[model samples]
Target: MAQVLKRFFDLIVSSGAILLLCLPLFLIALAVRLESSGPALYWSKRVGRRGRIFLMPKFRSMRTDTPVVATHLLEDPDRYLTRLGRQLRRSSLDELPQLYSVLVGDMSLVGPRPALFNQRDLIELRRENGVDQLRPGITGWAQINGRDELPIGEKVAFDVEYLRRRSFTFDLKILFLTAWRVITAHGVSH
Candidate 1:
């Protein structure tokens, strides 16, 4: 019953957001193409539920040739990030495209963020902890709490907590917290 309600809410909200953001997405795509030479959307393989592989779409924010590694692992991740990329990432606009994923049922508006295919350790931990059982999300408890700054262990812990306690009200609170976090520029590291 709750899952039905959550899915219904996901459909309406993600659909509405995608429609509203289409223009901004176009302009951002144009800017990225004008500033750099790569696809406007960057698609990388990500680990989804039950070890399923999916192509996660994000606004192209870094040099196309950047090695597939965690941003934190980069010597100077900022250097590879394009000029517009920084603002998009800082404002969380880079993640807007994932709304499409939600609409398509590959993701939810709130769940555990997907792990990169190359993130063996993170993936392993998530699998061990059953975090991979849930659909990946655009914004999540981990996202609102610590975002990129959180270690994989801490992130999985938060994700586990979310899985256990999630409810319609909890999701609403997380969404509200996400809005506040974005506005205040909290916990965004990169």
Candidate 2:
């Protein structure tokens, strides 16, 4: 019953957000293309619900030649950021494209952010805690808590806590907090 409600909410909210964001999305895409040589969207293989891999679209904020690796793992990742990439990443405007994923049922508005395909440790921990059972989200408990600053172990701890306390109210709180965090650019490492 709760799952039904969650799914309905995800569908409606994501659909509305995508519709409203269409123009901003187009403008962001144009900016990215104008600053970089690659396609505007970066379709990354991300671990999704049930540990399935899906291509998640994010605005391309890095150079086309940047290696496919976690931003944290990159040695001097900033060197690969495109002209407007730093601003996009700082404001998390780069994530607006994932509204499409949420509308398509590949993500939720609130849950663990999907792990990159190569993040074995994060994937293993999520699987162990049954976090893989939930759909990945554009924003999540971990995201609101520490975002790029948290260590893997700490992130997994937050994810497990979210699993234990998962509720409509809690999801709403996280989403609201995420807005504040994004606005302040809190806990964003790069």
Candidate 3:
């Protein structure tokens, strides 16, 4: 019953958001392309619910030659960032494309952020903690809590907590906090 309601909410909210943000999305994509050599969107293989692999798109924020790994893993990650990358990432404008993932039902508007397919440690922890049962999200409890600043174990802990306490109200709280966090660029290390 709750899952049904949540899905309905996700659909309605995501649809409206997409419709309202279409022009901004297109302009952001154009800016990404104008600043970088690669395509405007970077499609990443992310681990979704039940360990499924899905392509999650983001505005391309890094150089064409950047390694296909978590940004934290890169040696001197800043060097690989495109000219506009830092601002895009800090403002989280790069993540705007993921609204499509929510619209298509590949993700929720709130839950655990999807892990990169190669993040075996995080994936394993999530699976062991039953976090994999929940759909991946565009923004999540962990995202609002600490985002890039949290260690993997701590992030997974927050994910598990969210799994245990998930509800429409909780989702709304997370969404509110995420907006605040993005506005302040809090907990964003890069």
Candidate 4:
């Protein structure tokens, strides 16, 4: 019953957000293209619910030659960032394309963030902790707690906590905190 309600809420909210932000989304895509050589959107392969693989779209924030691994793994992440990438990442405008992932069944508005497909350690930890049962999210408890700065183990701990405590009210709280974090660029290391 709760899952049904959550899905309904996700659908309604994502739909409305897309409708309202369409123009901004378009303009951001244009800016990304104008600033870089690659496509405006980058399709990242991510591990979704139950270890499924899905293509998650993000605004292209890095150069075409950037490695496909998580940004933290890069030797010098800053060097790969496009001119507007740092600002986009800090402002989280690069994640705006993920609203479409939410509109589809591939993601939730709130839950554990999807892991990169090559993130074997994180994926294994999430599966072992039963976090894989929940849909991956656009913004999550871990994201609000410590966006890119958290260690993998700590992120899994937060994911497990979210799995245990998930509810509509809790989801709303995570969303609120995410907005605040984005506004302040808190916990964003890169």
Residue 170 of model 4 has an lDDT of 98
Give the per-residue lDDT of model 3 (tens digit) for 71-140.
9999898899887888999899999889889888889999999999999999999999999999999999
Model number with the top lDDT: 4
Q: Give the TM-score of each candidate.
A: 0.96, 0.98, 0.97, 0.98
Candidate 3, 106: how far from true, in Å?
1.0
| Candidate 2 per-residue C-alpha lDDT over 1-190 given as tens digits, one digit per residue, 9 for 90 to 100 | 9888988999998889888988999999999998878899999999999989999999998998989999999999989988698999999999988888988899999999999999999999999989989998898888888888899999989998889999999999998999999889998877
- Evaluated against the true structure, the overall lDDT of model 3 is 0.92
Alpha carbon lDDT of each predicted model: 0.89, 0.91, 0.92, 0.93
Residue 125 shift from truth in candidate 2, angstroms: 1.1
Total clashing pairs for each candidate? 0, 0, 0, 0
In the predicted model 3, the residue pairs found to clash are: none
Off by over 4 Å in 2: none
After superposing candidate 4 on the true structure, give the runs of residues whose Cα lies further than 4 Å from its correct spot.
Answer: none
Question: What's the ranking of the predictions by lDDT, best on top?
Answer: 4, 3, 2, 1
lDDT of 1 by residue, 111-189 (tens): 9989899899989998898888888888899998889889889999999999999899999999999999999878888
Evaluated against the true structure, the overall lDDT of model 4 is: 0.93
Q: Residue 107: error of model 2 in Å?
A: 0.7
lDDT score for residue 29 of model 2: 94
